[model samples]
Target: MKITSLCILAIGLAGSARLLPSQPQDEQAKSSATVEGVFVDQDGAPLEGVHVLNRIWPGAESSTESDGDGHFEILLEWDGNKDGTWYEGYARKEGRAMLKFRADLRAGQEFDFGRLTLTPGGVLSGEVLDASGAPLSGAMLLVVDAAQQASAPEGAQADGPPWEQVIDRGSTDASGAYEIIGVPPGTWFIVAKHESTWWLWSEPIRLEAGKRATASPFHLESLPAEYQIQGRVVDPGDKPVANAQVATSVLSPDGRFMMQTTARTDESGQFVLFFSRLPSGTVDLRVQPEGDELDDGSLLDVSPGARDLVVHLGGTKVLRLHVVDDTGRPVERYGWGLSIDKPGSFVMTGSAPAFHEGGYATLRVPEHPFELEIRSDAHDRKEIGAFTPDALPKVLEITLTSSQAISGYVTFQGRPVPDVFVELVQRTPNYLDGVVEGHWNGLYYGLESSTTHTDQSGRFRIPNDFPHITYYARAWADGYAEGTSGPVKVGATGVHVELGVGGEIAGVVSVPRGLPPGGIELEFYREEIKASSINTSVGKILRTITDDDGSYSQPHLDPGTWLVRVHPSGTLLSDLGWSEAKVEAESHPYVVTVQDQDTTYFDIALGRDEPCILEGRISVGDKIREGYSELLLEGPFALDLDFSGVDEHGRFRLVARSSGKYRLVINAGPGHHQYKTITDLVELVPGTNAWERDLPVDQWTGEGIRLDAH
Candidate 1:
């Protein structure tokens, strides 16, 4: 299973590999770990129906229901990087303090927390209103602790203190009123938000033990009309092609995925696509064959415009394939399917064709540069190389080899380790090996099929059902570091992995004692050049938050320089009760070096001296309509700048600290889709100063995030 591994920063199980192993050994074949616990309220009564979850990273995550007696029994099958790792245990129930305890969990073991008690929490009530003085329903609200790291929203009063961890969250009702229970008693702030348009926080709200507090009503500005792409999809003959799929990807200037919104054409072959905010990347559209009528089509690169647009699709062609084993016998389908992949295409391409036991496929495909893949279980997975539309024969005959099994052992410090997850991954792009899965994302045959687990003796078997491709054998287990072997071909014998003791980064986060707060989140990205683009592709090595004591630590980080910032969770990213990321006191990319088997100590402070302001207005084409912003202003890791706030007029103000002389990556969706680094757009001088410039939006061009190389 060559996954192209495009998001390699997912490093290990972060998001790279599947959560479960294909084959399990001994105890793993059973349950990897069991955590049992009983929950009670401060009054000693059973707190039934608490949500208990086993939080595992790069591993399987499972949750359990609490019995009427408040007892929860969570079972887990872990493929984690570290052994006997300490993971965050979460339990939540309305009107109760959310429990975030660190628990020691070892695979193949059962631990019971005899009696767990939860604290009774207070409640906070508030109302949200739009600029018209009318109630705004469906608005989300959260109360954040005063000490956690949190970046303020644009236009938020600068006089208020910073914040961290959400004590509680709730949504507004039809009356635009909200009441959030289970709030930990302390000093906090009320944050009212509605997607990207309206997000801002209150001054502060103080609550006492088991009490109720009312916050000041929140008033937000009116939002503008959303961006829309109105167009018609047509066939090569100039006839309307209805029911086609039109999609576009939103990516950061550095090629980071931002979001995606799609629309489907109606009966007239006309489509209207709307985005809450205009996207900053080229839009792509495709038309799949409609019952025996039209075939698939493509609209490669298109910069959406404000008016009428037409999409001419390349119609489909007929293709017949007869697949057989190397011995001239017809291949049997073990349920694996077949598909045509345009390796470099951005939008989802090709029709999903399947094969029965006879191994024959007759499918219509868009006339694009694509490779054929026969991913059947009973045969050695076949990759039929790339073929141009005119170069393909009317009927193609391909021979596959009998499927072969892959066996391997996992060892750490020369000792066999059981229950480790082992999977095969692509090491490089090979046209003859498989289609290019994704250019910027990397290329791979598939994910999860070529995966298995080690048994007590540390042996794993990838069931004999993978294509003959080069792959890196990666092994991981809880309580130890993840390990990967150099590239090896399929059907190789005695594949082995030797795990290592990875390094750690530990530190304390501080703030001006009398000032705002400590901070809410901490996210750091490891630097590694993507094999496909020779450009930086990112992933988080470790995820952690500053504890109440102001200390934080990240384990199992691959040795390298990492850029640390106060980003959110799941992006495993974080908050000060923060929805936005905060640039820390240090310089951007706050570089820290971590080495194998060593612990790097690095402390950080919150709130620096007054920041430097870099102000600019973007004059890109009128692609972005009024009352909306489709532009993003950002550098590597913006310190104090609120990059999310590029107003409808394309005007932006960046409050930065020590950014040096650097040009920010203006992720303008139009004008250019490819990137060539820009420099010195603004020279940020020392404390409390401001600089302004009007951007020549048309002059900016970039390499699109998609991988163009093989």
Candidate 2:
């Protein structure tokens, strides 16, 4: 059976099913079942010389690897079992480019269904050159395609499709020429980056089948700069500290500091940084070493009201602290942070110190007084006495009592949602990621190690074992409403809570009569709240599906905005006549807003068109391959192609449309694989009923993988 969205959201054990509903015993004696054909590209042309695997039956694999005509097939046993055992179909990773077909059979039954198509992805090749017409060596390039425009249903996401990828990387040869191939046919932007700072970009390029488009010579010019800054680092004994890291983050006019670059201190503890290139402005230089701790201090302003200037750092001292229980045993592990406030001053800076062997680390102010605040995971923060740098680095060890715990269970419509996501947050005046004030920090106590599933009965528990912190719990499930609990204060033990059952979205896909000829696929995606590159379950997709519209219905979708798109089978689009009409409702793409207890309905209609044919041919080393071509049009733009062809005697003609700047993509069989495209736009007038182009299939000399595993 094919993987489903429900399986993805059902947690672990329940996802192991490899087959759908089975067939009856009498059907098990069938002599054979028909297999589907595979094509290359979005176009329905034959794909020759490829592997195929059967998931349900062990040792049942087939290899036809197409002939020069891109056509082949295999036989399989599909008779039903007495106990109604079902037959499952699937292709192994190596055969992913090919499609699998299932069979309904009985004893002595014979299946003869034929014709399956597979489309191989297209490729793009080009060179990066310098001002003097020489290839640029070691130039880092980034390619971004224009295909990031689709909106998927909630929880399902596509990793920037084939048309988009970081497709190539290599240094130029001494001859000053470079070639980056193996890119999917589409519109792409090429950016040549120099080091991490200096760089340049080329205008967007488009690629077509069997052609090479040359780009005008590109150049990289350095940005102008002005002014400079310097600084130094030292240890508590006033000795120069080498190898310390120092950085400068200039603030924007909007008061936000951009990310800074790090530089190391020299053997003399001194450092110099050129601030040219950067617009004239006030910049903050922060210095620190990986292993060294600093005593409480303030930024020393060198020039008041000046946008640019120099500054120096004095030596720093370290302080050590230990927090434990009344029994005098050291505190094992917990979150710890500190705050420094000088005498007669309202200013204070909070910091989280690194924990070592017997205690925690902090900065000690020599001959000065400062206060300290200590906090732990799930525990309330505590303030300690002020001390000067003259004081000993080690402070007295002590203990703090534990806090209360809170727990909860969440369900939807009387059923426990196993994969429900939960979070505990505290809204307070706090510092996070070195920033003084921001909305709820993306931190959840015990989240990483905690079990995030509800039992069969829909029961869940969150143990809050800490020392005086307060929190609120929030839970969410896809396709259902989300719920949150009131704030709970934990003084000594945990508190219990339960959430109400939420609403669900259920509806069958009712298609219009005379449905178009094509297999359809669906995908989903959720909305994001905040910007973050780090990995966390929060804001990430919970599930997705490549198929829908059967008796089964997916559940547990949280209330929010959802989008759904219909991707018709590449086969029908390539072989049959289908009007290229965008999917929309009321003249605009459908927009759905889901809420608690809300249920919605949606039905789709497919468009049709008059039949047309296009022709093309290719060649590679005394071999010729011929096949059909397909073109997908969008508004005034027609992009993307899928065609399978073969090469024998060095020539071959495929058929399709004869108009628009189509993303012409073609592939050859096992003999000699030759694939290439033209990024430069091309125009083909309609009513001609024909188009012809010649291509070359390069022979394999035992080279590495030409295309990445999609």
The best candidate in terms of lDDT: 1
| Runs with alpha carbons beyond 4 Å of true place in candidate 1 | 1-36, 42-45, 51-65, 73-90, 101-114, 133-138, 147-179, 223-323, 328-369, 375-381, 385-397, 402-710
lDDT of 1 by residue, 435-462 (tens): 2223121222224455656777998656
Which candidate's TM-score is highest? Answer: 1
Cα RMSD for candidate 2? Answer: 24.1
Model 1 TM-score, 2 decimals: 0.41
Query: Model 2 over residues 418-459: C-alpha lDDT tens digits?
Result: 656665655433221122123232223324322244444555
Worst lDDT 10-window in candidate 1: 1-10
Worst 10 residues of 2 by lDDT: 3-12
What TM-score would each prediction reach against the true structure? 0.41, 0.35
